[model samples]
Target: MSGVTRDDRVHVLGIRHHGPGSARAVATALAELNPQIVLIEGPPELDAVAPLAAAQGMRPPVAGLVYAVDAPSTANFYPMAVFSPEWVALRWALDHGREVRFLDLPANVSLVLADEEESEAPMDPIRTLAEAAGFDDPERWWEDAVELRYHGLDIFHAVLDAMHTLREGHVPDLRTRRREAAMRRVLRAALRSEASTIAVVCGAWHAPVLVPSAFPTQAADSALLKNLRTTKVAATWVPWTSTRLARMSGYGAGIESPGWYHHLFTARDQVVGRWLVRVAHLLRREHLDVSSAAVIEAVRLAQALSVLRNRPHPGLPEVLESCQAVLCGGSDVPMRLVARKLLVGDILGGVPRETPMVPLARDLDATRKRLRLKQSAAQQDLDLDLRTQSHLDRSKLFHRLLLLEVPWAESAETSRTKGTFRESWTLEWKPELEVALIEASGFGTTIPSAATAVVAQRTAEADIAELSTLVETTLTADLPVALSGVLAALDERAARQHDITRLMAAVEPMARVRRYGNVRRADTELVQRVLTGIVTRITVGLPAACTAVDEEAGRELRELIDGVQRGIGLLDQRELRAVWLSALRSVADRLGVPGIIAGRAVRLLLDAGLLDVTDAGGRLSRQLSMASDATQAAGWLEGFLSGEAALLVHEPELLEIVDQWATGVDAELFDHLLPLLRRTFAEFTATERRDIGLRVKRIDRGAGASGIRSDDTTLDHERASLVVPGILELLR
Candidate 1:
């Protein structure tokens, strides 16, 4: 062997990452071995900062980061948890004053390999072996193989044998070969040193290959890493979280249940009792009913399940099953709460003040602190009523972060379906957001400036719709600095684009922002100015645009005109409104214009009082004449009177014209018009429809021919007075 001696052979402590049992075994084995040096599998580039893991107030669920010196965004994380075997091993070395080093392939090469190969490795021997053994869950198999069975130094030997057996005919991919070769090279160099006793800890899958007999020669391993492309890299440590660890985020070697493992690792006695107690605590906070009796039953159930499953101690599965059956009453709602809040806790870890971060990340952190917002691995719900200053500030911060493309918070919807007063957000902080924040440093130093820069950058390619959306986002974020630039972009896009539909689509959103600004008390004067210009253009082009089209185009233009009309109503300027209404009146008068649009124009004119009651009745009579096809006339009527039932109810002449049209239509034409009539009537409330029906019935009976009477003679005062006493008695 390259650096082997029979008297003091190097020990390979095989371990499962983040496994409590493995962690315990590693601590015990390291204590007994008393090695002068301990080498752990991590980015070798991060060896100098490995001691940070043991610093005062340092906690686990922390990660050692290594990134390109020139490009901080290109980084990798080797996360550590308190229950992690490697973490325990590192702490052991620190306490014992033993030299420790990270021995994996350097992060520069690994990051490149990772970026190049975005897909997961096709070969996963551990998962394959678990599947072949009829274990549907690989975590269960790992628990049985290592966590449940392994103890003392015996585990080391068992792991090596199992790994060797699995790799008897296995072939590694090129990336794996390079990685293993690097690990081997580091071990050989460590062994060749002056240290007498050395303990090497690594993944169980790599333990067998670390042996000198099974590993490649030192010279061969060196050749594979020599003349490699490399980048200057920096290393540091950052805080992580238990929820992130349990969820595994995207780490390949993550534990299935970090919370369960933590319980196993920390609780000295009454393991089931502690877990159930935590569950009860979580349930109580949510105002759910849980009691001591339930806890006792749960403990008993867990024990019984452990016995039934033939486990040496109650595992997570047993506890979960027991929790589901007894405490949950077979309901998953309370159980899910326990699983998320307790199993995957909301505990967030923090790094020391000395830790390094890019300028943007530092600013972001400062803002988070200022807003009293916590960074959690688990998703959290934030309900903000923009009426409050603090809530508005928080909202602006989230929007700015979004503009930077660092999705720490996302715009979500609240249960309140009716207004803009409330805003809901789902906040989840990922480690990679740190990298993204670092990348965004080139934009600006502060959140507002960076957001402004981002908007400016997007303006180069954004179309009118996109610019309009940006405008709304900017207004909501209260980024006044970015607003001018975004509006300029929108103006530029609008000037270049002549598509009326697109222009009209842009109009409504601007009007919405302007109106909402009134509620938020934001200065919407700029939006108003831009909206005026858009309305002017739309009005100038609309008369010509409304004429001569097919059914689909006609329908589309009608909808667009309707939206533009609604938007015109939102504008406070009378001149712009006058121009828009004039264009609509012209479209209504033009014979070539489609009946649907003409109907809408007439409705707008009537609503604006440009058309009198007499004019509206005449227009209705003309539109519903027998000369027009039933379908076309029905479409016009639907466009004109569908939404305003009062127009049909109060305007007797208009109602008579509609009645005549309906009565005069032949059976086949009536069939064709049935759907359109149904759709129109569907818009009216039951009372309005009932009143209209009664009017028609009265007209049919010649009861309304005499017109409405206001005389009290027809209503007998004596008879009515007699009924009042009975009505009063019934009320009492």
Candidate 2:
């Protein structure tokens, strides 16, 4: 087996990534050896930003972000936590003023060669060791062996020996070989340099092959890395989160319990006791009944379980079990809360303010600071009163980010009674959004500029509906220039657009902006003119659009008609309403119009007082005539009563017409129409449907002239007399 010689200048420390015990051991070993240089396993592209780790605002749980300059989304993160061994080595080297370098293949090459196939199957040394030790879980075994135990420098030596044995006859895949070659190449360079002593910190799996005696010649290492594909890569420091460090988060080197490891690293003594105390406190905060006595018992139980399991110390499993038993009373619900809030953790790290960032990112940071809106990992609800300048600006900023496809905030539903002056939003900042910001940097250097550019680009291809949405978004964002371009595109599209349904769909947003523009102090005259033109075009083409339609098309046209009616209500302009009502009348009078459309048109006319109750009853009676197709009659009823049945309850004439039609239908036709009729009535509230049912019963009993009912002589007077005394007492 390969091993480091006693007199060798290079000391290799094999470590588990993000392992607390490994991190502690690395710091201890580095202090003792005081190596002249330290090497860490990461992309070399990150070396430029490595010094930022020591910056004033620099924090752990941050990552070295590297990405292809041309394609920013093709990226990789080299994350470091407070308990990471490589992080310990890096800080040690930086504090001692020793030379430091990354030992893996450059990100530029790896990113370009990402698609290359592996030459062989990779081996899991940890799993192999765990199985040999009679443990099913490699993570638990490693935690017991290295992470939970304090082995100092000896643990690294043990890991190295075990890995050597494990890899005695194993052949690494091409990517693994190339990565090891890169480390070796970096090692050789450090050896040739003036540094007399070097410390290389890397994953344990690579430790055996990295020893100089394992592959003495440089030619093979050089051959593995020759003429590799490359690209220009940029690197920077960005904040990270503990949640993203979990294995379930799809990170390659993620750990199961970042928060647990963090607690282990930070607490100097009584690891299990401290952890249980924290759990007790968390449970208490959640309004659970956790007593100090329970915490102490939990600690005792954890230690006992560790001993029973033959563990040197209480590991995460023991502590978790103890907590579940004592603090939580075996309830899984509180434990889920513990796992999410304490185990995986919601901790978000920070980077130094002076860390390198794209211009757009910098601008946004400045804007956030100026607005006093601090970024947070936790979700927060923001209720903005747009009448206030600051709130308006904040709303605009969120809208701009949304337009640029950086969804840091999502628009939430607000109470309609709160009026147009208030907007609701949910804000949650994520670390990956930094990469998104980088991707959007090419658009412009500022938020407004980038958002405007995005709108302009999208406007060129936007249909009338898309353009209408864009217009509203741009108006809300308060981008006057982009709004102008979008309006022009909308007008151009609306002029020649033959799809009247699209024209109808555009009305609501246009009418909304025209009506609420005053709240934002925005000019709405242009929107008003555009809306008028759209309404006029809709009225002219709607009659023809309603002709020659199938069932699906008929349903769609009915919905569009409802939408246009709603828009006209929002505008509340007499001229537009008159024109729209006239159009509906034409649709009702036109031949070959779908029964649903004609029925809806008559209903709207009656609601608007353009048609009297008698006229509306005549139209309905005609639609439901004996000669009329049963399916057509059902469609007409569905379109008229699709949303509400209150009209039928109040308008007894209309109800009588429908009742007659229903009673007149043959049993066969009624059976065919039952499903359709049920679906239409299902849309109504229970109260409305009940009221209609009661009215129908009255009509059937021939007592429709009066709502009151006569007394019944068959009433149970003896049973009713029991409630009479109680009713009299309540009345008093």
Candidate 3:
């Protein structure tokens, strides 16, 4: 709330935020009643741009950019697009030779407020409404919600009121309340600034709250926000299109409908019913199926519904019933489609024929024309994905420009498929994208250069966790131009620098490609060679590097080792696995740790399942022989691990280790290890054991079920083993 409110109040124009209809109406209202001072609801950070906004050639969709004075890298933006009410209000003020001012919270403090509540959640009000109305599309649900208004006069007000209420219910937080208070403060200041009647334009939500006489003016450093920061602001106009207003986006200006509201504005004498019929005719011409007879029937149905609801004039509901009957053949089929087209029709805007320009607008037009993107018509069936993966190189500039996340070029895609790296793009030249490109140029000249610059700026401003994500994205790109920036970002995230997840983005990729010289593949050679050379210096300081990794990180290193082995060519597969084994053994020895016997066993089990499992009883028997040594134990474990036997059952002949040690070993020592043997048995569920019992026992369960039973001695031994205290404890 850091804007200037003047006593020279000019005009107060209430409007719907981003409402094209409201903008058009306000423009007319302003021209008819000229004002000297115009105030708008916006972040006061753009106060510096008041002159810029009023300047010739500036355009809408240009944001009033604000960089935090304390941290220049930290920026907050308030964007405007054509068809926005505030922009129109400003233009009218400028045309009347009046001063225009932004009246709202400044960007830095606003961002601080928003950042304090850092939650990126979307509400499900629309989704819930869609479900209630039996429509999956949120837009369609809105149509139904609004369509209900046609039933009667009482219902019409109720319907609009309900929609408004629902909208409030869905906001993540009640920022609007705070925003409205800020707006009121600005409006009161305008009144105190010497103007009798001031023009204050803002979202309709703030209209009821902006009562000047009842609301007192706020001081510059008011109690609500003593810590607020203020800056300059501006406004402009730009061409708009239908698709950009689709609500498919997260942030931007919006005009949910243009054409229908335009009709509502222009044809004051024509009732809404006749207007809808005209819409149906337009739909029919577009091959959308609304016949003239259908419109007539729809009108009849609407009148009947109006009578049924006991209303003098049809609201939105009766019109809907009429549409359903006529357009949808008594079904909610074609009517729903026509409803969207008429009510929430696409957002299409054009430059004003005679309007003062903002500087931002001229620059955007020039950039778009230079890039050969001034043509707005979109070509269908152009799949950029396949084309890129194919041999088509549009140009280095085009390829690089495509990489920037400009939301323009995003078109409505009625496609459903499960595929990676697929995105919907509309590919139009918008003033906003051009503005962004110029803004990005502050960091670097070219698009890639600008991207790198933006990354650096953001990284400089981001916290540790955010910086870590940037590192991951940079690693995925794996381009050299960002190397310095990546390292610097890594440094900023240094509090989390020791986090292996953070370090691994830099480490794992390098490790994979490091030993490429050992491979015979040509596709990955150059990158791998570079990666190996880079990591070689770091790898040379092994103990130092290992200190950054915790035990869990060590386990991940093992997994990475496995991944690297998997990546080796078929001819070198065994060699690669052996290399990892040797490396693991070396690392283990250096750390004075036990060999990874459990890891060896687990890896084997996962890889080959029961089919490759060795006979645990037989292997143990061999390993425990009096002639066996450490080497022999090692050899036996290697063989046992090489063949996976995650499951086991014992036979006396197979229990040679028990037979050899049960009589001679320290009884306590042998008992302590027995739990492991019992756990192996208990690991499998009863059903699984019943099915696989014979496999491990080498008995044909089908034959055993045939009444061929095991001997009495075997049964006795099983009972004794199952009864042991340690074994029983393990079972639990």
Best by TM-score: 2
Give candidate 3's error at residue 436 in angstroms.
8.5
Cα TM-score of candidate 3? 0.50
Per-model TM-score, in order, reads 0.83, 0.92, 0.50
Top lDDT model: 2
Query: 54-124 in candidate 2: lDDT tens per residue?
Result: 88998878888998899999888888999988889998888888888998988888887776654444455
Candidate 1 similarity to native, TM-score: 0.83
Tens digit of per-residue lDDT, candidate 3, span 1-732:
101123423334444455444565567656655666777887654454455555655644444445544443345444455556676776677667787777776564565665565443433443555577665333334334543333322222333244456655444344444565676666666666766556667644444345443354465325556655543322333444444443422123333454444454455564556776775776677687677777777777777776776655554556666666667667665655565666555433444323323233344345445655533523323334422432122222333343355544443457532122333444555435534543444455445565566566666776544554454344333334564565455454443345433333444433333333122121333334433332333233333444335445544554443433333322243533444344433343243221223234333433433222244444455455655443324323332333223333333233223334334445565465454434444545665445343443443223431234355544677667866775335444
lDDT of 1 by residue, 113-208 (tens): 776655435444556666887654454566677656766676677767777788789777766677789988788888788998889898777777
Note each model's CA RMSD in angstroms: 7.6, 5.5, 11.7
Q: What local distance difference test score does each model get? A: 0.78, 0.84, 0.47
